[model samples]
Target: MHVAVLGAGYAGLSTARRLESRLPPEVDLTVVNDGPDHVLVHEVHRAVRRPAVADAITIPLSDVLDRATVVDARVESVDAEAGRADLDAGETLSWEYGALCLGSETAYYGIDGLSERATPLKSLSDAAAIRERFLALCDAGGGQVVVGGAGLSGVQVAGELTALAEERGLAVPDDIEVVLVEQLEEVAPNFPANFRRAVREELTDRGVDVRTGTTVERVTDGGVETDAGPLAYDQLVWTGGITGDDATGGDRPTVRADLRLTDRTFALGDAARAVDADGEPVPASASAAIRMGKTAAENVGRLVDHELNGSADEFDPRLERYRFDVPGWLVSVGDGAVAQIGPTVLRGTAARASKTTVGAGYLTSVGAVHNAVNLAEEELL
Candidate 1:
């Protein structure tokens, strides 16, 4: 009666926590990942400009998973049919059921020099690397900076860099520029038009060059070579794309409504191409991931209970569908932000406060009260 949850990002942590509360006490639960702490994936961009905030946002897996075994190792591969997983340290885990929440890796869009030249903003290490590079650029008296992908991540990074430059004031180059490149016609395509416009306005107001409908042909050491023209920059940040793990790979079968890839296994978050009733792909947001994780965990509990009861095949428990109706999204630029919930879009300090409120609520949900308070203080103050 062992349940193994892989890769403890938002989806993994959420699933593991909910499963612990629902499953029988005797059911052994194991949560495995490369890091022992669950870092806030979404806030890593902010952490770049504010490094001290990382500690408060990251929660130790050991402290949170009192009912589960915590394994700190890279998961090399998982055999769903065999109910086994291979780890990087030459170890194996056998489980009766498995949930894949390995998340995703940055995608370079087949552009030349992008991977080598651009610094991605995804993990804690990535954020630290961005901070280091920015520091170097500042020390060198500042220079032009180009960021590819005007999605929320790109927008946030560009905004943060702009804020950082403003803090530096005249210490950096007066001619310094920050450009955001997006192939799409608008930023945050998934968001409503008003919200997108609001975010764009914020970027423009902060002196960010938002070039939409411009494709990056390739990245060069000196700058980004876009279809429109070549632009020189001292730093280039790529927040373009991501790809998921195997069972949720582009080459494999799509995830079912129950969030299952196989009868004994499930996939959630960026690891799966989860769709709604109309088969529309779900946005890869933290909110969606949390909801998907909860649904998947509930289904697993139902299956485990049925198995333990030795119920007949026809008497199987019902599985709930993954329902991710994310009310809205928020994008921050310095002390201000643009948030949308339902049909309403808001801006200014209120929006900024909304973002902090969401972060605090998430920390509370994950049983990190102290961390929540600290994050609230760091963000609000």
Candidate 2:
């Protein structure tokens, strides 16, 4: 039996690793990704301040997978009904079972000149470019640095930029004005009220000019055009929103708790808008993606067993359903961090430690033990 897994992000990598032990030795497992390495995307923001940390967050596929064939190519489209996936390299892969976890891309939201003007913090390259631009601005005697979108990514990058400026001997707000703008009423808008308040406090203490309820209408060469007024900036970084992968025509298709796109195909992670078994909307986060991947892997295993046994049963095998249950949330602001667990919200040293632990834990879970050690040393020490 041939099983193909698309994309090597958090979801795809987790599914592939679990499948190795679940499937039979004779089953051919292939993983297709645009890159050869799986990136700890949530930690990519750290690279914006410390470029050397990039290696600790990116793990090569060869180091983790024992039996899967890794195909490094972009997935152009997935025809689930046909059980075929077309690659950008002009090749097609046919599979008996498939898992689609292509992740997402930055959404410019049809804002004028935004796509061309703003640097997004979604990848290693994006982090590097943002660092370069910020450093150049500092060299030019400092100016306003505007960050569009006050989501987790935006808030993290804004904090990193402030730290970067201070490291370059620039005064916060005075020399380098770090402005964080959000259309919502508060930063980390989707999170709990207490967590949002803590994040805003940390950013404010770090000299970030927090602008809530400010909608960005357009982007111009000089600065950002917003509902409030024109906010001038020497550089702009956007972390506003994300859309589905291009393979799915930039739409996050709905998926049930089982994470199945078709009888023989599964879709999870940011590529699909998923609802849990209890009918709760699953938020697009690294933790959520990993959980969905695990659940999907088990369901895939059940299906494989049923087919191999040649079961004449009229109904398909009972598949495992995914539930959206996460322990907490964490976000870093400059040197400090914020963590929300249940009804409690924490900040300062405890929160910072929690944030570091989560990053290292994810690395270790992915079989990147060496990388995990390096990440811990870099983050904690």
Candidate 3:
């Protein structure tokens, strides 16, 4: 009569909250994660320009969870079959039902010197470091800043860097040499055509050099080694690849249709290779993770009820599967942004508003109204 959820990211938080609302009062629940507060991973990029935004984007776990034990400890691994999770501090937690929603980390791809040379944008500390280092470079007479990804995060980081340079009166594209390198031929490979074009235009307008169809082969202290050639840069950031950290999160284990790695143990989010009703692999994104987390929570609740009732029947509860849907896409680039919500594609004020609304909506859903309101005020004002 217990359910344990791991990590406090989008998937874990959503699952825990939904479980609290659905599970019976007798059931004990525990949430194990590495941190006390939930971070808005997407908003971490903006902290580069507005450092105070880091505070507004994080909410203490106790501020949201109503009835659950929140364990702020690093989980080493989960023996799903054994129903036990090992912690980094030589402790183990046992559970009847569990959900593994530990998120992803940067993938350095075994490229020589890349891990040591390239900075990653996977955490709040990464963003904060970028902010600090970028300013330091500016004060040291500014040089080339190369971003090794043209994805949403990379575009946003490049945009923020561009704005920060302009704010500090650093040279636009010349002295800074802010370049966004993408392996694909387009800026946003998976986005709509119009949105892709819009992002490219915005980067161009913001004086960011956009290099398409370029592959980064290695990283050096001086710059990135790519298929094109050695591109000189003072600071290099990698935002292109992501993979599950197996030691922290579980390995990408095969899960049953109900997302069960073992009986009473479920795996969701980036840590699991999840599929939908049609058996197609679901892509990892915050939106997908949130939806999958709720589904997993509901299924876990059903299993708990079956166990407590001690049903004589087969006790095969019908489980819900995640249905993939493009719930729209929004990318904010400094003062402007572009969004494609359903059939509508927008830019400028409409897009910026849409982006802000999505962010505020996420914060509101997690019961961080004060932080949401303050973020809005800080962003707008």
Candidate 4:
């Protein structure tokens, strides 16, 4: 029996790896990915300033998968009904059983010209491009900069920009500014109020202009036109938001619970619209993607087994309910940090240390133990 997995992001890779480890020897597993390496997405923001981080965040696909066949091709079309995917090379891939981990794309929010003018921080290339623009601004001494969105990515980028500016010992010109814009009245809207306050303080302390309850009305070659006014910017970074694979205008119903698109077809990670068994939506996060991957793999195993043995009685258990609330969140603001776990709020070096530990812990949990150690060592020294 053949099991095909598409996409190699956290959700897809995690599912593919789990299936590789547990499935029977008779199962033929194939993982289709557009890229040769799995890019650690969370670190992309930091990579904007720390170029060395780029190498540490990407892992070659070959190093991780032992038995699965890796197909290096971009999926152009997915015929879920026919259990097939059309490749960019005019080839067709068919599968008896498959998983879709298409992941999400950036949500432009319909802002006129923003998609063409702003550098989005979605992929490694996007991060690198932003880094270039940031450094250019830094080298030119000063310029008006705008970071759209106050979500996790926006907060991080704003912080990193602050750090970068300080490192250059550069003072903003009378006309130059670094502003963060958010539609909500408050920044970091998902985090607790206390956490949001801490972040605002951190940004304020670092001299970033934080604006809330504002929307980008339009974007042009010079800058973003906001509801507040025309904000001129030499560099514009978009950390706005993202939507599921359906953003491509595909007709696949926004993925169901259990991460399955149809019988024998599953969608996991950002590509899938993750929802609970009760049909409630789950917040999109890396943690959710990883869990969905494992769950999808287990269910795929059951499909393979039932087909092989004709045992209708032994179907894999129903997909488990996934509920998550980040008890605490951490954000690095230049050399310091703002962290909250439960009601315990921390700032300064303690918070910075916590941020470092969290980063190391995630690396280790994702089977990047060696990289984790290297990171820890770097931070310690």
Candidate 5:
């Protein structure tokens, strides 16, 4: 029996690792993805200004997988019913069991020129480009820096940009603003109100010009055109929203309740539209993706054995459903401060510690135990 898992993001990597340790030795497994490294997505916001962080946040796939073939390829599409995947290199491979773990892409919410003008923070390359752009703007002297979408990404970018400006000794005139524009009244809307308040206060205290309850009409080369007005900027970083990228991930034909796409195929992570026990759609986050990946891996193990047993009993597709409770949110607010946890919020150095601990916990959970420890050391020191 053989299985193929697509993507190397949160969902894909966790599922592959689970199978590597759980699947029978006779079963062959392969993990296919475009990148050579697994990006720690939650840390990507910090990586926008700190290039070295990209290295720490990404781990080589070879070092993490012991019993799976890691294929580095840009996936084009998958014929789920046919159990075959086509790659950008004009090669197609067939698998008995295939899993789709393709993650999401930066979502531009129909804002004119936003996609064309703003730099998104969803990928390592995107983060690096933001850093380079900021540096270039600094070298050119100084000007306003505006951030669109005051979500977690926006707040982090604003904080990091402020810090970077100081480090580079760039003149940030009082009139030359560092602004964050959000459509919502509150910042970090995903978190609780208390946490949101803490985050707002922190950003305000850190010298960020917060513009809540504001709508962006478009993004221009100079700056974002908002309902308020056209604000000038030398550089802009967009930590806006996200949307599904079907070009790389497979389109949904029909996903079984057991998490399988076809007889031997599966889909997990942001790429998979998994319905929970209540039939409610799961929120797209790293937490949900990690859980889905583990469940898919377990079901894959069962299918591998079932194939070998040859009992002729059809696979019980419903055995693949997974439901769990996990609600922990954390956001960095510059100056070594953070807002975190569920309803309970932390601030100052204590909040920062919580944020660091949470990051370490994720790395360890994803089977990068040593990397988790190393990252903690680097982050703390």
Candidate 6:
């Protein structure tokens, strides 16, 4: 009667929180994460500019959960069929039911020297490293700062670099050239056209040299080799893409609407390539991950009930299905933001407000009331 939830990102934490209310008091619940805290990954980019912001976004698991026992260990691999997960600490975790929400790692796409040369923006340490390196470059009289990705993370970090340059009294393009490279024809390539346009406009307005359709072929100590040409940079940050966790191995494995990897194991968030009820692929975003986690929690709860009740039914219990129906998209560009709701796209104050609200709302939902207030004050006021 033990249930295990792996990883402490948005998906894993959300699932664990929901399971606490759904499961019986006798059932044992455990959460395995590499760290003691659940990081608000979507807001980690803000830490690149303001290191103090990390305090508000990193919530200790103890503060958020009451009944679940938190196990701070790295998940090495999961054998869903056997209901077992191997940990880096040389211990095995066995459970009756499990959820795999191990999140993702940066994907270098096998680009030569890229992994060695480029710093990724996936963790708090990564953000701190990026800030330190960028500041050093600025102190050395500035050079080109290239971000090899134009996705939301890429765009946000690039914007932050520009904003940081201004704060240091450096002339943006003249003193510190911030370049955003993307293989696609535009930034935010997968987003709606209007949202894409708004993001590009914001980047441009902030003095970012947006280079669309520019693919990175290789990375050297001096600079990057691209389809366009070689571009020298003092510092490089990669937000290009993500792959499945090492525990899951390879690219993200596909999971259906039920979010099940096996009869008793569920996978959600960046840990799996998840699809909605209609078979539409779900994008890797915090909003989508939270929804998928809750959906999987419901299914897991139903399975727990069915098994504990000793029903003689031959068939499995009906499970809840997940649907990717997010209402809108929001992204922050330096001090500016953009939001797209249905057919309408918003910018300036409206979009900034939406961005602030979403971040603060997520914090509040996770019972981080003081953190939520701090975030609102830092971003809006």
- Root-mean-square deviation of candidate 3: 1.8
Give the TM-score (vs. native) of candidate 3.
0.95
> Residue 196 CA error for candidate 5 (Å)?
2.2
lDDT of 4 by residue, 300-356 (tens): 886777677877566554553444445677887766689898898899888988878
Off by over 4 Å in 3: 248-250, 254-257, 312-315
TM-score list, all predictions? 0.95, 0.98, 0.95, 0.90, 0.89, 0.98
Question: lDDT (CA) for every model shown?
Answer: 0.85, 0.92, 0.85, 0.79, 0.77, 0.92
Model 4 stretches with alpha carbons more than 4 Å out? 172-176, 245-253, 277-280, 312-317, 325-327, 377-380
Per-residue lDDT of 1-381 in model 2, one digit per residue for the tens?
Answer: 999999989899999999999998879999999999999999999998888789999999999998999999999988987789999999999998889999999999999999999998899999999999999999999999999999999999999989989999999999999999999999998888999999999999999999999999988897799999999988999899999889989988899999999987999998889999999889889889999999988988888888888882657888889999899999998889999988899999999999989899888988899999998888888
| Clash totals for all candidate models | 0, 0, 0, 3, 2, 0
Model 4 error, position 51 (Å)? 0.1
**Residue lDDT tens for model 5, 1-381:** 678888888889889999998888888888888978898887887776667666667888987888899889987887777878888779887787777888877778788888888888888788788888887778777678888888777888888887777778864445335789888888887666887888888888878899998888887678677888888878777777766666544343334346766666787676766767666666567877788888889888777777777853875534567774466666776555665565677788887888888888887776677778877776687
Q: Write the per-residue lDDT of candidate 6 for residues 1-381, one digit (tens) a residue.
A: 999999989999999999999899989999999999999999989999989889989999999998999999998888988999999899999988889998889999999999999999999999999999999988888899999999889999999999999999899899999999999999999888999999999999999999999999999998899999999988999999999888877558899999998988999998898989998999898889999989989988988888889962667988889999999999999999999999899989999999999999999999988899888888877
Global local distance difference test of model 6: 0.92
Native-to-model Cα distance after best TM-score fit, residue 58 in candidate 6, in Å: 0.7
Write model 3 residue lDDT over 247-361, tens digit each, in one string. Answer: 5442566564578778868888777778777787776677777888888899899888887888627756788777767578898888888888887778889888888888888
> Which of the predicted structures, 3 or 5, would earn the higher lDDT when compared with the native?
3
Model 2 worst lDDT window (10 residues): 310-319
Angstrom error at residue 370, model 5: 5.0
Predict model 1's lDDT versus the native: 0.85
The lDDT ranking, best first, is 6, 2, 3, 1, 4, 5
Clashing pairs in 2: none
Clash pairs for candidate 1: none
